[model samples]
Target: MAIICRNTIEAINHLAFRLDLGPDDVVVTTVVEHHANLLPWRRYAKVRYVECNPEGTFEPDAVAGALRGNPHPKLFAVTGASNVSGWLPPVGGLIQLSHEAGVPVLVDAAHLAPHRPLLAAADYLAWSGHKMYAPFGAAPLVGPRRTFAMGDPFLAAAGRSTWCRSTRCSGTLPQSARRPDRPTSSERWPSAPLPVPSQPSGGRRSAHNEHLASRLRSGLGAIEGSRVLGPGPLVPTLPVASFVVEDVHHALVAARPAAEWGISVRHGRMLLRPPLPASLARD
Candidate 1:
């Protein structure tokens, strides 16, 4: 899942940048993002943040309202699940809202790659394949051909690749294995990134995550103060849970070595910027 584009947002832009999209192309996204998904689209466009409910699940109607705020939102972004809370959002209605407004919807499936169904209801979807039992460094941008046609040739020519950073990619690679007279496509496109190595996902990792989900639910059974968030029959959250621990700092709890015993996890607001205080993260 190597993201060859400069970033996930760049992948989105490269996939849809040509439809004469402009600064006025208002974009709507939830405050909860992986930074990779939110930054690029917001960088070149107006981004409206949809608020999450108290339980951390996104209010689908708020997203619909935001899309209605602008005359025609060029794009809408949302997470398949909160990286922090492991909450899958109400995507169907949100997609409907954007479509009703003639806007294209893009789901940041980075976290959901390990949880939710891959292509639920987004017009232009972005995800990290590396997260989906694939090798590190790969990501995916899935969209219909019509949506992909928005890509601009200039963006392509600029050689803006997310995973490709070294000048060697844009320049020349003398390490070419190609014969002197043979010019291969991979040699020509030095930045060509390979997606995560295809692996048979139906294996121990799957069983392990599934077992973790069951164990977590059983452990939380009839808890006096805790409540589950998002859809019921919880569609396989990644060996991760986001319940509150009274008087406990999530950061500290997440940092505890015990967390590694189950599965390594990060704890915080899924949306990195809007809710986090300056002190929590350095500028």
Candidate 2:
């Protein structure tokens, strides 16, 4: 079953709440997640973080260690892709590893879903609509019904009730709604078809983005004081690139171009902190 949330934050929060985590519970996660995936679990459970390499990538051994080493691990949370370095983790393999260790897996696919297929192997999955160019907030938390069968939703409201009779009510699982719930609208969001990389136009778009990223890397590297971070362009990644120019503040790197030449870029430490050096946190 799926619950439509206002965003990935709420979706993940709902999942974390329904899991009924306690202070003694441990959650195994990686350093590559956005705060949406990381913070929710922190609210209730002790977190065991799996560290990544300089390139924002981690091996299955790391996951294995966390799963086997941590006490009371109830879930394994991971990002399908990194928003900062555009690194794609081996999610399917990670999910299998988690299962073997008897921990369910939750894949935060907000960044990855826009570019590739969703990981079907994940026991629970969450992704946002804004990342997919959807018009408004709509994110889905998908998982087994039993997890949500008994809990009061993270948020309780009139909209969540399928029907109300006297003091008794039948409500949606883990209510992640804002206003009066319209099942049709929320249900349609996840079912909506997205462009697949295998399609002709999608192939072209992918090629174009890769070409752009390659050129971006080459261009930035050629600049006297600048260096591109993360894996080289040959690595399969989203079109995103992060870099730094020596002796320049990251804010200045992003602002100058946008103000002077209409070139918009983003900067600052992405929510995932460690992989990015304090100096090279521009995108």
Q: Which lDDT values do the candidates have, in the order given?
A: 0.57, 0.77
lDDT (tens digit, per residue) of candidate 2 on 117-163: 78888999999877776645678788887676665536555555555
For candidate 2, list the clashing residue pairs, or say none. none
TM-score for all models, in order of appearance:
0.61, 0.81
Decoy 2 TM-score against native: 0.81
lDDT of 1 by residue, 27-133 (tens): 77787666665656654666677877665566767887888885567778777777655655667777887788887787876676565456656776676545545
Q: Where does model 1 exceed 4 Å of error? A: 1-21, 146-214, 217-239, 243-252, 259-283
- Which consecutive 10 residues in model 2 have the weakest lDDT in total? 173-182
Q: Flag regions of model 2 displaced more than 4 Å.
A: 159-193, 196-208, 269-283
What RMSD, rounded to one decimal, does every model reach?
A: 8.8, 6.3
Clashes of each: 13, 0
